[model samples]
Target: MAKKRKVDNLLALAVLSTIVERPMHRYEIAQTLCERGKDRDMAIKWGSLYTVVQNMAKAGFLEVVGSERDGARPERVIYRITDAGRVEMADWTRELLTTPEPEHHRFVAGLSILAVLPPAEVIELLGARLDALGRILEVARRELGDLTGTLPRLFLVESEFGLAMLEAEAAWTRSLRDELIEGSFDGLAQWRDWHDRGMRPSEVTASIERGVAEN
Candidate 1:
């Protein structure tokens, strides 16, 4: 299998994409990101944007074009994307789209240690998360609806993918909560007892067979 490479930070991708359209100063890159609502999707801090620009320049992904000064304002060095930048951006985008790499999410990590908490407590926490996901789904749906006529589907497809994933997660969470409440999950007793006994030596073999053995 080919190694999967992707952009770990959105600022790099955003800056490269922007400079490809036209050379921009550091401030302008930040401003354009905000204006296009790119910041909402990524953590594009204004303070760090300049540093990123400097680093990209050092890496030869970007080149300083010319400085512009308007009246009392300081001259800002404009930047344009280099051949390297274009290549990296394309590779990053393609990898992101075509490759399905596991991304870190808090809920999954929480689930890994979920047995540490009581089943009821776990259900409550997951319920809260499901409610929040419901609200986010509603907001995404409404926003997508509002944009339907005004913008192209290409612009909102990212949002659509996000919404679909959120919907699936919410549904799965709800089902899990229901199962816990109804004691319908297979091996619920064995699972609970395994955790309660703290994986005793005698029960280790059975627990392992049932797939509840904890490290």
Candidate 2:
């Protein structure tokens, strides 16, 4: 289970990581985060940065040291990470590294209701998805290869991990598609029968439930 924290938004963690170097105003923090590509690494809601920053300050994870103004622009509040913020950041990062949490994927969601689609159509869709994944992997592999010599492995590890995941998905999708095409999948017959008979969705679901109860 994930522990609840004072400021749960990942943007707060990015802010803490950035300002730990030095105090910066909100705009500076956002710019620094963008420059560092934190947005790509995390799910950052740009519009919520200000609210997340304010919430962290209110929770004592960040402290406002002073304010600064540039030209006729409105003053921006400078914020620095507090001791508590450092502790929280370290602990949160450690928790993330040490723990496994369930994450929902759209592909998994589609698979969950997959029986609703005819077996042939499902096979077609899976092939299309695999093709798309192949294209994505091709581009990612080229980019990662280009960056390998330019950047340290430490900096490129995330890209490598992403590529590995794409590869795994592509392999699994290809295997499943092959099973469907070969008529080797265990439930393929029943799946096709349901569609060929034009069984209504509710009737199909009820039949499935009865089968489960019997087993």
Candidate 3:
């Protein structure tokens, strides 16, 4: 049998969603993803992102609608979603939200399994994340403010709720970071040793598979 086609399914879904919003060239898609990911401190790996795009094109989820020339570079291929792509995107979105939260390597899972991380290091990481989250919450607040007179009431309410949730998370992270810093936990060395010795090959593979599945 032909090797099963394996692509990052979530990444494919994200790419298709972007294309459905508006047909765009590959570079434009990369730029859009970078912009969207700024709050999360993430940028899609270009090679991997393009690979997913190409695979989707081959799978008939996307069609090359046209080409665009930009200065000295070769003509860039612009893509549009086909009907199948729309159906797939809708299905993925619904399934993603409705699916139970996966149990593996979830933030909680990492904390539970690798409880050996130095308290200080964990605090530092959480503090940094909280700072990033605060910045994102601020931007969201500003965007909502700008939409005050322009958006519908339902959208406004939804936006407010999102902002509240972000703020709550930031507060929680801050509290946890403070506790860790004050506690002077020194578990990292022990945790690393445990992780290196305790986990078997099968367990490690299972962890990796769970990570992939969760993503």
Each candidate: how many clashes?
A: 0, 0, 0
TM-scores of the candidates are 0.83, 0.91, 0.55
Q: What would the TM-score be for candidate 1 when compared with the true structure?
A: 0.83
Write down the RMSD of all candidates, one decimal each: 3.7, 1.8, 9.4
What is the C-alpha lDDT profile of model 1 across 104-201, one tens digit per residue? 98889988766566676777888899889988988989987988878888877877887788899999999999999899977577667766777754
lDDT of 1 at 25: 92
Give residue 93's error in model 2 in angstroms: 0.6
The prediction achieving the highest lDDT against the true structure is: 2
Worst lDDT run of 10 residues, candidate 3, spans: 1-10
- What is the C-alpha local distance difference test score of candidate 2? 0.88
Off by over 4 Å in 2: none
The lDDT of each candidate is 0.81, 0.88, 0.71
Better of 1 and 2 by TM-score: 2
Arranged by TM-score, best first: 2, 1, 3
Q: Whole-model lDDT for model 3 versus the true structure?
A: 0.71
Candidate 1 residue-pair clash tally: 0
Q: Which model is ahead, 2 or 3, in terms of TM-score? A: 2
